[model samples]
Target: MASLLPYGDVDFSLRAMAGRAEGFGRNAIGGLHGPLYFVTTLADDGPGSLRAGCRRKEPLWIVFEVSGTIHLSSYLSVSSYKTIDGRGQSIKLTGKGLRLKECEHIIVCNLQFEGGRGHDVDGIQIKPNSRHIWIDRCSLRDYDDGLIDITRQSTDITVSRCYFAQHDKTMLIGADPSHIGDRCIRVTIHHCFFDGTRQRQPRLRFGKVHLYNNYTRNWGIYAVCASVESQIYSQCNIYEAGIKKKTFEFYTEKAADKAEQKSGTIISEGDMFLNGAQPCLQTQHTEGCNMFHPSEYYPIWTMEPPSHSFKDVLQICAGWQSVCRPAEISTNLD
Candidate 1:
């Protein structure tokens, strides 16, 4: 087995940790007090496989020993108190993606999820009451249903520094219009690159989401969607529509089997629009929807007036990277 630049008792950097994301999942200490588990096989399941580590009842910091594609037969269900740290190797999951449900204290960092087939599939599905999760520096693309979906009352999640590309229905939050319990869902997304995705970057519903420092460009349908009583705070982001020229979309949905429909609220602060991306170009829906502001959660947050300078920064920083602990780079720096 290979080592990944000692990150335990040794002096190292935690910058790559998903918990480092500055959002609702900032408190997610994923397997920090657990033992290390090395994944030495590319098999879908069994010993030395990713499924084995993810299914463990106890906490574990799962690392990959070899770099290859893992063709999953079904959705890889992840349990609580686990950290799937892919820093030393390049691993990709195909055929199916991850299923995070009813778990907590999990961190998924620096991996690639692609080509997930089957209906209702997603690159990383955080569904059904899961909380305290952080997904960082991941590259998700070409999923059948969505690249990432956080629905069904999940909260305290942060998806930062990830890349999305070449997919329709890129992301969905709060899938169920009838599930009114989704109002408790809270997520923070920052430093992500939504590149040429079709729609749902993401189509949100009933969740209070904080999106900052993201680069959303070349959207097919629309860049961002606010639907069904969601409160979205889009700060310091960049939106560049390719041919659509539409940035925001407002969708109405009836909740809890009610006949009356209501849309969500959006507070766009310091966002840059390019390539004829119209900020007011939304569906024929009524405005003045009420929402909780990001200042209600944290009085202060990082926000800069959006600019084209963000394009280069997001393209370089967002997505999976070959990140080793600082112990490996300290010597070279000196």
Candidate 2:
């Protein structure tokens, strides 16, 4: 077991044990208490750019900085009271971004994750028995599965201010459908953006998911789905940019098949701004405990001004040109 104290010292001996790859270096820096270990890749090479490291039982503070892409083909597990801060840096982890397996008191912040080519190359995979985890300000895109997945006994997890895009399946919280285990509980998602053009909207399987102030555009399906016994508090969510379908649909078969579930509610209190240029679909759901409330607004149409006639028309078009005509109109008319 690794010690969580002596926060500032870097143990060079642990480098070899942690499997430091080529082109990456590990150093210990003084932090709050014990030494804090920072693993960095100084090169911009191809595939194998990041150094691989793990903490099973000991406490650690790991930082990965990649100028280019990096791949972690295996699990990057962090134990209790550990902090994995990427410091608003970019990292392309070809496999799982950070796997919290049966751990507690873990915090992951300021990292970007790009998935691998496999089926389960998720940004973060939380296994059963993990608790009190906080994932904040991270960006996850282009994955086969969801960006962040919580399963088994995971509970009390919070995800905020993140951006998820180009995922076949976006955020998922609960046990795998095939596996029979305890459900995920007490999860919160706030102030995030989900651009799900590739797949359906973000989903929550089996937990209490609080979603507020999220922006979803160009989504293929419902912006939010709560299948199992989950309570979703949705407010100030701009769904579908008034282009695609507006209704929130539930897969009733999937919801009913889940063990002893309760249908959730959708609360829309604030402005549901819709650009009248696109058609809108009424919100829909299974007939039961589910509910939908939409704010009333006059659908506003944004009209594009007529094309410029000539220099005479151009003079009249100058003052309002900024907001009226297309940006290319100026150069074209000139």
Candidate 3:
């Protein structure tokens, strides 16, 4: 039931989308060969807002020609080669959200983050030492804390075709367990659509995540959460359960003086559970944890083998869409 998207037609090419940023952000290349900035109001800051073209510092690519909702009153600090490109206008960013500290090449696409209020608000907050990031097709929801919060030593990131709802904790990779430099986090979530959010659909401690073909459904308090020495590689995802069907949860932190580390080593390949879904995995690995394999980070990171047709292709191709794209595409980056 989601149609009607004719924002005056579009034609975006955007430098041929630079190889479509994949796992480990595939070298972001954000404001890809720079210069474009155009967000004509819905003010939250001066001069054509969007926080004055994401507090420009150099490369730009921000786009938007007005479509509605942009309430934020703070926390819009986005620096580093930017590219907030919200497809062909249909934007939405409610009160307080977005803050990628210590930035790097960034690329936040399509947009629509809902009501995010006071203290610790986050709809997108990559922190500490951000790196090449690529959050595409955004559409987060009611937030107070997390909708996306990559912590401390943030590393190469990539969240694709997004669309989460309601909200509870919903995403927090490596922050606690005394930071421990977050073991140089490296994320790569694919084709997202964690609808009924509740628990951190993303909850890692010392990161190295890489889930694929996501389409989680009806979660409440357990849908992928592993504390301490984190490392998840649940491939071909498609869990679907309502009354909490334990899709992995192991929180018992206490690292870096290491004594009480519970569990953190998820390696469920070709996943696909329905109705009473469950993968409650944790079959050992609490001894100096370290077990990752996304082909050991880049050897071919692109998959799709869990279908019921991605539950309607992740609710009609994830979020914030208005079809007909191309208000600007910045030509031929040489």
Candidate 4:
């Protein structure tokens, strides 16, 4: 029928975008007070290059106008108050990856990461104490460790409008349960596409997470997981399971030393599942333990009514919105 004719794409595709007002990672602005800098060369490291500019350790807007695969020889260590905007071109990062350690207020958007391999490489690694980050409209595949890894007390992050495919260990919020420092990790993952990933659409630990409005197709093993004191709140997402009947939405794994212990918590609301996907809620912890609740962190968001069904919203708005491309906005910091 006419209803099936890429209706979702017509409404939500990148071609429909006009500006950045509806961008999902809209709040993640790093250094709007500074001047805008563009990546002029494909050189990974040089006097005036991405690697050199990021090491300046000052507040600035970084944009890329050229398109090429930059094979990083070392993990690009980003400084504080930097925004790497790849919106206007097709930039690909391969061979190596980016690292954010103890940084603040960074924004990464509209790029592609593939064919990366090296010592503990990831598409983007949010290291300890990193905060106020926004990653959106990116594509990632075949990373050595994870597509994205937020660990070591990283907080106030939002990952949105990204396409993740052809990978294993898609995302990880917390590295180890016993690393009590990870208790401070809090992230929001919204409107992303988990396509053909094997596992860990995000295996969590020792953090508070909120997942909303995502579209998942062809999950290899499982969809969402919570492990070791992690509190995950999933809302209004769509999941299409793979061939295995065990392609579930929620799962719990035994922590390293606590094999018999109940792991984390999963609280979901209004999620859609198809193709024999059924996930049982599992939060069998001991009595009187202080577990985090979803409502306390984020307010419930409502979608506009009629004309668009839940399936349509997932297909159209989940990965990338071309019509409303991401733009830099200034804050009231003056």
TM-score of each: 0.90, 0.64, 0.35, 0.82
* Candidate 4 ranges beyond 4 A from true positions: 1-27, 247-260, 283-291, 300-334
lDDT of each: 0.82, 0.49, 0.82, 0.70
Residue pairs clashing, model 4: 14-321, 14-322, 14-323, 16-323, 17-322, 17-323, 17-324, 18-323
| Per-residue alpha-carbon lDDT of candidate 2 for residues 98-201, written as tens digits (9 for 90 to 100) | 67787776666556777645666677888877877766557778766667888876776666556777776777766544443434365656445665544434
| Candidate structures ordered by TM-score, highest first | 1, 4, 2, 3
Model 1 CA lDDT for position 329: 30
Report the CA-based lDDT of candidate 2 relative to the real structure: 0.49
Model 1 residue runs over 4 Å out of place are: 1-11, 14-18, 257-259, 281-289, 299-303, 325-334
lDDT of 3: 0.82
Model 4 Cα shift for residue 54 (angstroms): 1.3
Highest TM-score scorer: 1
132-220 per-residue lDDT for model 1 (tens digits): 99898899999888899999889998888899999989889898798899999899888889999999888888888998888998888
| Model 3, span 67-111: residue lDDT tens | 899898888999998888887778889888999999898888889
Worst 10 residues of 4 by lDDT: 14-23
Question: What are the C-alpha RMSDs, in order, of all predicted structures?
Answer: 5.7, 16.3, 16.8, 5.3
